[model samples]
Target: MTIDESALGFGSGARAVWASDPEKSRGRLHAEETSRTRSEFQRDRDRIIHTTAFRRLKHKTQVFVAHEGDHFRTRLTHTIEVAQIARALARALRIDEDLAEGVALVHDFGHTPFGHTGEDALDELLKDHGGFDHNAQSLRVVTQLERRYAAFDGLNLTWESLEGLVKHNGPLTDESGNGLDGPVPQPILDYCARQDLHIATFASLEAQVAAIADDIAYNTHDIDDGLRSGLLQLEMLEEVPFLCELLREVKDRYPELEQSRMIHEIMRRQITLMVEDVIAVAQAKLAHLKPRNADDIRSAGQAFARFSPDLQDADRSIKSFLYANLYRHPDVMRVREQAAGIVRDLFDAYVRDPSLMGGHWRTGVSGFDEAQICRRVADYLAGMTDNYAVKQHRTLFDRTPDLR
Candidate 1:
């Protein structure tokens, strides 16, 4: 039952010096016997896939509601894509592929049912209660909330996994403890009280790859989804020079290709080009940094895995266009408005009548104060799938806003 050593980032399949060696892992909060069959990172990845949280992703929104269309990417599909791209980047950069894949898979665990719309609503509702950050919540899920182990309430993931979950994009605070991106989330700081993740430094290279893979994934897929939903078109895509060039190439190469195939072709090529750009940028940076070990990567201060300057500019252009065209489109915004209302209404309903949350969630709510109750409610609401949220809203209110 032993995994091929090569597959676990060892032997001939082993990566460069800076990869996070599972043998060197900082280990889990709740100590358990190591698996004889799997690398710690691989164990983390498998554990994530088996979690109730991961399974819920099947019905969670990525860009479109699950009921909007069958083929549009759900959170689960997007996560798989992110993991694929992340592994590619890790393989190319000679880092731990399993760790990268695991981070990518778990990155969106904290997102609410209706994508950003649900998150925005929840954040507002909990603002006085220390607010909510998906990154912090992600760490919370793995370290404090999964409740699978008898000895631990959470999954009790390794420190490296938890660190990547919390600080994949960058450090949460500065060297002087000032928040780098406004106030750091309370959940993260509270966790740090027991396990100092050194929030002032960069996460490992595996984490950085997962972070950029997210950028690469959503940028390409959202456009594809936007087109599928009729919220975006080829004509509008021409406004993005990067996309325009890619589209022009596709047209010139296969003028007679059908719309679906043409879009898929464009997406694959876009992913290839963006992934290559990241590899090149990271290699050049790594050459200069010459990190001897994983620790050196953290203290290096600046990000190593990055898009080149040109690619970064193109990334911004794509994001801006999506913001204007797809995200802000009147129809989409209307749906988002309704989605936000659902989240807000549900939070209030749960707070007013904790019994409405029934099951184990209800029995646990008795001793909580206002903030604690709100947080528990937020967690319950956040974990709901789009269909469940809609059902709950229908059960609570005589009328629900039609997302369509």
Candidate 2:
């Protein structure tokens, strides 16, 4: 059965507002007839939940190494927090909550083991083979890497969701030019188009919300972790003029705030402030336009724009502080170096000889070549927890016997 243009989500007006072509239908699933019916956004959410990438987040690092503390936030927990914040903002703004949730859940699904440290190592190692980027890798994973389904090669996510994964940076840069710092050139535009497979331009408003929420979650949570790790003092935040002022304002409003409660309250306040700013900016742009028809409602300038400059600058400051105070501390760097060595060594061993790989990897002989071997080795290293990677490293280099 063919879907009429009118019956679909986008109408004539939507087509005009969109910078690119509207998303095309990818054929309906036969199982939808018998299984409980879900909205398109809900299906996106469910698909992310069941994917191996999503599950692997459980073992991936958030800030500290995965084995540092059992209760510390893993990549999975961070994703959940970002999703919760994104869903709250989406519902408040009448956006598709499920779509926001889905984007938030899988945003970091491509993160390598040992968190950003491992990602950096992979980038250095694979510079010749198209430098490894988590965002680009994310698109590759959902589009081609995953092998769960017999019918499709990937999770077969919706175009909107995939776009969210790639274009989450908002109006930062076109991939060639440094974001906000460099002039937009033709070369930059061309590079942006080719940077990632799914995104050729800026993200939608909903995707931008997810991106901002990720910033909010990490900024607040990382500070919390730093305090817990005894690396950062709440008082030291006062050294930074803007952060000091913000903290002072927050404390003045809520005098009963404790260290434990302060993080949650500060995050809540920042999110509300940012959401209101986003809505105001969006509405200001659409204020002059009059809706011609039903299509006009969806076509308004609601999908453009990004978090205000003030917010972006503030977020950058927070990220810098976290990197200096926590992420790059000697304690953290030591573990990161150790993890990177493990990944590098493992990649070297497997890529040199695929026969060393056990289980399902051994069965495929002619089909398994160098590129395939690299991916399999990457898969093994990427799936490891911090302790597991260390143990594997010991087994390979220290002549420790493999119990498994």
Candidate 3:
């Protein structure tokens, strides 16, 4: 018997009315002839995949440090998973898959070496100098760093891609053009001054899916990793009712299944349930909002793609559980302290003598002020992989943590 496409979450094969169209794109920052063979968003995805920052993700932290274990997910693997989910959701919603996937792939480019630990250390060290934000650093990476093309410094992605990357969570500003949560990062604000990304408006549907896909990917995988590392046990998951239910279902289906296979079964089912929930919720919102075009999605002032109210609670529950059991666990906290020390030591060493940074990073730093020097050092430091940061710390400081 044939199955209905709609039942499978393939909502009417035709493109949705509000889907982002490549031909109607907002174009790139630095103008160049469009590729004959690829859509604008495809080019954006391809360029991101080829960047040095993208390659560095392989050695960057996700939850566990990169060297923790080969089986654990790294930033690169997490990005790939996010991209896969984003693409699947985009296809189901009949939106722009390339744009969604591009956004997902590039979202974590700005993250420092040791996941949030490194970012926190850097932020505290530079608290006086606008602080460190991975999102802003991501924008800086694509727009100013990378230095690939002859005419342009960055990959020069399309405005849609850039907008999605910067506003992955949502609009950075409110109706009066004031930052909502706090001051918008200086790097993002500076870039918008040159090319208005309409930070006040919600991003396109493609971006919305990418952002939520990030939530889905990390929420599920971190638990998988935590379980693998023995930081989290199957019994601990009972704290969250949703996970408890999934665990019960898994056990019922395969009463004698081994722990590893049982965990994988639960993870795959969890992803499916979450993805379907997002698609259904988004589809319902789209029906109500009746957006006429991609711009309508941005100007709607609300995120269309998201988990339902119940699932939102579930999502929060999972995060709370992870934070308590895994992220803030004594063992993890110990490593975090060591990781933060490395970042702090490196920052001090670089700030004291820019020459310690070496090469072009040291070239013009002698003429710069304290803030300028710190920002430059941050740029160099943020680009490092987990191994590289540890190595650098070992070189400069008398002692270094093994990060085991």
List all candidate RMSDs to the true structure. 4.0, 7.9, 2.2
Comparing 1 and 2 on TM-score, the stronger one: 1
TM-score of each: 0.96, 0.77, 0.97
Candidate 2 lDDT over residue span 91-140, tens digit each? 54445667778889989977887788777887677655545667766766
Off by more than 4 A, model 1: 1-12
lDDT, candidate 2, equals: 0.64
Cα lDDT computed for each candidate against the true fold: 0.90, 0.64, 0.92
Ranking by TM-score: 3, 1, 2
Query: Candidate 2, TM-score vs. the true structure?
Result: 0.77
Clashing pairs in 1: none
Candidate 2 colliding pairs, count: 0
Off by over 4 Å in 2: 1-36, 170-198, 250-258, 286-305, 362-372, 399-404
Instruction: State in Å the error of residue 15, model 2.
Output: 17
| Better candidate by lDDT, 2 or 3 | 3
